[model samples]
Target: MSTDVLIVGAGPTGLALGIDLARRGVDALVVERAGELFPGSRGKGIQPRTMEVFDDLGVLDAIHAAGGGYPVGMIWQDGQRVGEHRMFDPVEPTEDSPYDAPWMVPQWRTQRILFDRLEELDGKVAFGLEAVGLEQDEDGVTVRLATGGSVRARYVVAADGGRSAVRRSLGIGMTGETVDPNPTLVADARITGLDRDNWHIFPPRGEGDGFLAVCPLAGTEDFQVTAQFPEGSSVDLSLEGVRKVVAARSHLAPEDVTEVRWASDFRPRAALADRFRDGRVFLAGDAAHIHSPAGGQGLNTSVQDAYNLGWKLGAVLRDGVDEALLETYEEERRPIAADMLGLSTSVHRGEVRRGEATRQLGLGYRESSLTAETRQAPATLRAGDRAPDGTLGGVRLFDAFRGPHWTLLAVGAEAPELPGSVRVIRGPAQESYGKGLFLVRPDGYVGWAGDTADGLPRYLARAGL
Candidate 1:
């Protein structure tokens, strides 16, 4: 079989990419090694920036319906509630930024939502097909599957997890340190004797004990149980083992944990690939970077990776843009990934709080080669910054930015004559954007900004607009 793009792994990253590409009319196939989608509450926090990406992908409504806001944390001592702790700093939604806090959706449920959207867009995913080996040339990539079948494509994306087989096949090296040497056990289970309103936290009572946290999984009856073990200790993921851990840590009895749905174990660590691209194959999500789950940056960063690449791939494959446009994928995302890695590590080590930075709305590509800031001094918004959401001339900025197209925003500035392909929104009251003409990329960043429309056309032609 063959296609324009071959995406490996059906996790949130691959599925989100599939949805974006499908809506853009890009012919792409998502292949997963497992027979079905992942079934865990791992990587459950959906950051605000990702919420915006979901909105553009047409899955925001469903995602909001399938998840709920994270609850406050309730600390327990001697089986009695002591104090309340907020997982994240509270921020109200503003007109410029809609989603203020993280939403809670199990990784499995998020992937399912993305998969359904992909299917709705006529996208395809072939299960039980694992990429074992791959050979790519100047034209395309041919992947050898473990099932003895081969698939070819113009490009391949490895959205596989941290121990990505495709990443290993490419011989790419990961550089980082273990945030914590202690092992951690994470599980989803149905339990009684606990209210679903607060996340229960159990601090170590004595020496050799570990911290335990049981958070109610939003939009579901199951609760995710996480426990830290001593260094050099192996974690137990069995149902009985989970029950024992719960009973030992919290006041609940072993019988309270009635059913264990899914469980796994891991050690907290962070790593990033030396490069994101290798010939025709590219690494994305955990394939390119690994993060400690502290600030919930791994999955959010991964999905955004797909969002960043989807439009570029669409531009080159379907919009006749220069293939050199593809080079920006690494040039732009690698640094962002590296920054997120540091943030996640800081959060893991208690050096940073999960606040504004964790929301990811402030991230941008001002230094990217694709960005052109021609204005003498930009105001609230600038080139390489994320275009804020607000109503301008009765048209919502997000509404205008939606879909696989570039947008020109003439804010308190005279509009220019441009190709009909670029959607234009003109308004004089958009406070988020001062008096300037902004060219918004398909990925929602302002690629070029100027005091007027003087260099706009040239910037467009340079960006293959």
Candidate 2:
């Protein structure tokens, strides 16, 4: 009937936020319309950055035990491996970095992991519960559930999918056009012919006539297969359709790719909401932005959204900061979401161009305000940047130190002990800010990184950290 925070949708973002808040001793609830957990692994394969976040959450080990990691992902043309490089392997630790190659797991599996963590903190997700109506006042949010019950919360976070009931309840509008009419055939099933170890990305090869990506699911023998739909033709999305996709793409027939587990037709779009928050209500994950799944960044972006907002919400409730601080959710994340939508759109466009640009320029958040404070000049990566991990120094800080605390990444021994809200860690001395001061948020993100600790206590005072 009441909670400190109420979250809609039990997917990755909601689950992660709920667990984070619960761990910090907040009363949180997650509501979902489906009676059962999400059935399949629609958005699996955690990215390197997100794995770092998981490490900070203190659950990386559980995820690692249950997840898998591959060394390389390559581009293929009709089963012939072409463009090749290592994106996941020899995961070396670089300056101020943490974690290794990303731990690959299914979307549902991730939710289960987060839910398990939440349960440990007196939290559980309610499936088949829907927020049909939402009303807000100065004190709290009033949510009308479909089951004829109601809930009151200091704040509500909408992690619902693209068709969000919470967003509609407010007057916020989702602005942007569909990137294209392109629909892709996606499956969470098994295939016989392809090698399971490597990420096999097929480009317009043979009868497939488009791209196909076959990746091994973490901790399971099952392999995830994805193939782009032909320019005009669409699958029926029935069990037979799932078989047909594999049959048409791979060297084998329908019988070759059996088990026929689960399948769907995903119409990937590039769209973002005009706003992410309204009074006591906020939008996150697919509720805030929608984009193509080309680079597997959709879920990562969503989870990061939760990581960014969870601490703010918890901090506000815990120690009493300005509710207005929540407005930064849009100011900070909207651009990131917008950038992802545009980047994914460009990647899909490059699929037709056969251009090398999209394949090379992975999305880098170097321009973020978190990194901007440490910006002298941008290297391949920078302070506010999504810190890239490569073998550097004798230690691995990023992956190893990921946890639910602010990290102060000192390039050298000059790492100062600024206690209140800033976290500090040490990395190799390779560039500027080696002895400088920087702060990493609890979610493995950079917030205030600078050469001096000046105005830092003030920054934390304002964030209520």
Candidate 3:
């Protein structure tokens, strides 16, 4: 099958890119190495910024309806109830606000929502398809499908999982370090001594090797456990090994545990692909970067990477923008992914010392020429900042509300009319007014966000909005 964009891998990243492009009416084909969706949980939390992306995909409701709500709060190490404070809560993205809280949802559930949205858009990701080889030239890229045939694409996006074929084909090296092997045992288990109400974090109890974390699993009482792995071990995440880690960190005995669902050996690392784009081919999600799953960033970061790349690709396909516009994908997303890696690493490191945040508010994007005029400090526009959502009536309209068209949540006092091209919502302005009326794109990232002076059309023109 020929497509304007050929995406490999249907994990959150590939699905996100596919949905983003399809929402914008771009023809995209997403191929995954796996035979089907990731059935079990992987990344189990969602940040505020990513919530906005889900909104854009028009699947937040389904996600929330499925397994999306913040029905519970975050928990701490000492068995004390962890408040929402710890979850990087940046005030609403309003020009007058400072932060918001990260949402909690299992990665498998999130992937299901994304896949459903893709289907709604009439896009289907071919599962069990591998990319053995591909050919690209000056104008377009040709992709080989493991399903027996091939696809010719105007562009290719390597949403492929770790060890990406497209990235290797382009010879991109990953630049980052493997974190200090905080060897941990992770598994699905049921325990009588522990409570599943909140995410439980147990730092090497009085005399243990590492930390033990108990995260809630959807549809059941079993919680996911993570603790130090034994000295000499195999990848086998059996109940006994899971019990060993739980006993090592927490005071819980594994045998008292029942209903072992799933288990695995996990090590956190930070990796950023040296380049996000090579010629007409690009990388998104794990194909572009890999990092510790500590902060539940794997799915969110990968999803957002494609969210940022989607509109640009759609524009290129529509013959409305120059190819150079696509460069912004890496120029923008790479730093954010790098930030996720660093922050997750920090949170993981803090597990040893019982501490962390570099800030949910501490993250944002002030670097791109897009925000240059706003003169907003990097702190307000840092690459990793939390996006905002609004309290409307009895309901809440998040900053990430996606439209079939572009939207301008006019954070300024007086909202202007810009025809039907952009949806303008005026109310209390952003606390960081200098960041201006945020011009949120359909994919949820700031396309041309700045102060009111920047105006609408000009912001659109600056970004080819």
Using lDDT as the measure, the top candidate is 1
Query: Which candidate gets the maximum TM-score versus the true structure?
Result: 1
Candidate 1: clashing pairs of residues = none
**C-alpha lDDT of candidate 3 relative to the true structure:** 0.67
lDDT for every model? 0.94, 0.71, 0.67
Range of the 10 consecutive residues with the lowest summed lDDT in candidate 3: 352-361
lDDT-wise, the better of 2 and 3 is 2
- If both were scored by lDDT, which would come out higher, candidate 1 or candidate 3? 1
Candidate 1, residues 387-455: lDDT per residue as tens digits?
999998899889999999999988888888888889999889467887888899999999999887888
Q: Which lDDT tens digits does candidate 2 get at residues 10-67?
A: 9889988887888777789899999877878787757766776676666678888888
Regions of candidate 3 where Cα sits further than 4 Å from its true position: 68-99, 190-193, 201-208, 230-232, 243-255, 351-362, 372-401, 408-420, 424-440, 444-462
What ordering of candidates by TM-score runs from best to worst? 1, 2, 3
- For model 1, the stretches where C-alpha displacement exceeds 4 angstroms are none
TM-score of each: 0.99, 0.82, 0.80
Model 3 vs. true fold: TM:
0.80
